[model samples]
Target: MFAMSNPERPVRLGFVGVGSRGTSMLQTALMLEGVEITAISDIVPERVERAQQLVMESGQPKPKGFTGEEDYKKIADLTNVDAVFTATPWSLHTPVMVATMKAGKYGGTEMPACDGYEEAWELVETAEQTGMHCMLLENYAYMRNVMMVLNMVRHGLFGELTHCETGYQHDVRYATIGDQGELLWRAHERYLHHTGNRYPTHAIGPVSQWIDINRGNKFEYLVSMSSRSLGLNHYVAKNYGADHPNAKRQYKAGDVNCTLIQTANGITVTLYYDSLSPRPVDFIYRIQGTKGIYSGTLDKIYLEDTSPVPHQWEDIEKYVEEYDHPLWKKYGDIAVQTGHGGSDYLCMRDFVEAIRHQAAFPIDVYDAATWSIITKLTEESVLNKSKPVDFPDFTRSKWRERKPLPIVNS
Candidate 1:
């Protein structure tokens, strides 16, 4: 358990982008004691003003507000801020975080922190050079179910973890197109024809922790493939008719992206990213070991030679309750009210703790960079005809000897 350096002095945070995700993150932060929103910045004036009102309404002093494209820099550079949390678009994550680190403040950025390998490596170099903390706000890594599995894996209940699978299998066709039926900048991405697992870390984060990836084990190489871009068009045609402008629009993102990864310790992981598909939200996480297997979707568990009914699956709820991640056991209720099925609050809590302690956070710069680089690696593999792309060693060589921080106190 980590404690704030000066427990009496409240942690000051400067937030940029008070839109959908940012608003939720800000609200969660507001709920925690001894935290203050000192400044809020966003490109939209209304969002900035709304965040200012939220902070004032929460009994905190009115936070300074700024609106414009580059105003986040002002917030990041504020001397009073202990940390900077940016929930902006994907392309801006790296730049904003890099700026925060250079300014000597902790930076917590939204997921897929970087779009490609080079930018992720840049973050590594910057964090090391500045000796600043930059964490990936990977909410999935903090989910109660995922953390429970992590605890189970650490206790050796699953035996030696051999291979695992995880993915972001959600239907976001509505978010992509929006209600107006116009392709926003976010959706325009789907209209392009590039291949690879564009988003890999959401699924990889919790699994990496379960298997101690980036610590003793490191991802080696990845082979990726993507189905043609047809899901979005199919959905548009089905609902909006073939004459709908979007139905005729060219989509570049594949219908589905499946990737295979092999770690240095001979562990295999399968990942998926399928946002355009018309399907219910799915987790598709499977933890496989020599002795047992667990499924996130089915909430089912099967162990070799150790079940009341041979070859029959049993409910995993008992295991989850017994081995729930200690972090969640302590704060699951608070997290649940915040968002993302209780993970968002935990993720924010860790980020704030890391900032206050100025110590190695649960997800350090190395984890952020390593997990983020998978996005670019997958793109390369897809463009190269599903050829294997070797993953980068962001740590130089520290991974083999690095030990993971205790995620759950046994």
Candidate 2:
């Protein structure tokens, strides 16, 4: 309900990192109705040039592109740039996001916002202290099917969800090794270097939205376990053994990782993440309630109500059209066509609106901190052989003092 008149000019936007994901976001921003790319920073000179080329191709005023990591701060602090989208490496996200927020600019970062729990806390604290919007851009939350599921859950169609399972299982070994060279940044062997649910945000974020976590309930604790590394490490050893000195040094390619979470309301959510597998992208989201059960994998749902025949999964489009969530009812259509089924657009729109309207972001620092902690704790659990680990009480009871965030358009 916090609509605002279109700005006299587009909101000045900046980007750090013009890699594959960064380039896609840059293009999407250019296509948005009221956004202007004022500046961009990238470590690779070629990437900077490519971003400039994209600006010219899109018929927008060419943004000033800065090269090298040091220059990112300069671009982020630019007076013309109102917000920044950070698609940098996992390790670099903390610094870039923190600097952007400290410079009094809004920021959106890719998933696994930081590499560790402490970094996550720092990012959250900085955003809260500076009163800047910091959104963890987990695009999966915006997928059409996921949004439809969320809408149903919100409407009580699922009827007191007793249990839920979700996961992001995709094979990115080629992209991780081939494109990133032998030193895979996010691969288990290179950067993450630990066994827990390294990337739980994508799966957990949507589930959290459906359940209204951090508002009505919060995660209590979690336990996690992982399979031993295989497949990709062999591929890496054979392909890049000479190029990477550590290629044959027992690569710890992450296998499947699973986490069982307990919510404060006693609801349970099981999260799974796997990247080394050689399977098609599968985000299995399943929920069971007192009245019905919903399964994203089968694209089917079952209900106990006999008054009306349960809706068929094929009727998802109809349901979405007729019974979308209040927030999605307003922006769902536009969101579906955008990246990650329209989540990227909604996230970007919210970031910009928060800046323009001086409103609190829907996903605040605490939410980010909690989600990040889940991932960090999952890893800890894996290291401890799936031992139950207590979730840190980040709110320290402050959440009891706050109400559910209103669905404000701005």
Pick the TM-score winner: 1
RMSD (CA, Å), candidate 2 to true, equals 3.5
Q: What is the C-alpha lDDT of each candidate?
A: 0.83, 0.74
lDDT of 1 at 156: 80
Backbone N/Cα/C clashes per model: 3, 2
Runs of candidate 2 with Cα error greater than 4 angstroms are 1-8, 179-181, 188-192, 237-247, 306-318, 325-337, 405-410
Tens digits of per-residue lDDT for model 1 on 1-410? 11235756888999988899999999999988889999999989999999999999999999999987888788877877888899988888889998888888889998778877679889999998988878999988888788888877877878988988888898888777756466765675434555566667788899889888888999999999888888777777777788888888877678789999999999999999888887887777789888898888887888886756877888876676678888887887778898889888988888876676666678888898888888788888888899999988998989989986586422
Q: List the pairs of residues colliding in candidate 2.
A: 196-379, 335-342
TM-scores for every predicted model: 0.95, 0.89
Clashes of 1: 3
lDDT of 2: 0.74
Write model 2 residue lDDT over 181-281, tens digit each, in one string: 45556664232456677677888887887776778788888988888777566657667664564454454425788889999887899898887777888
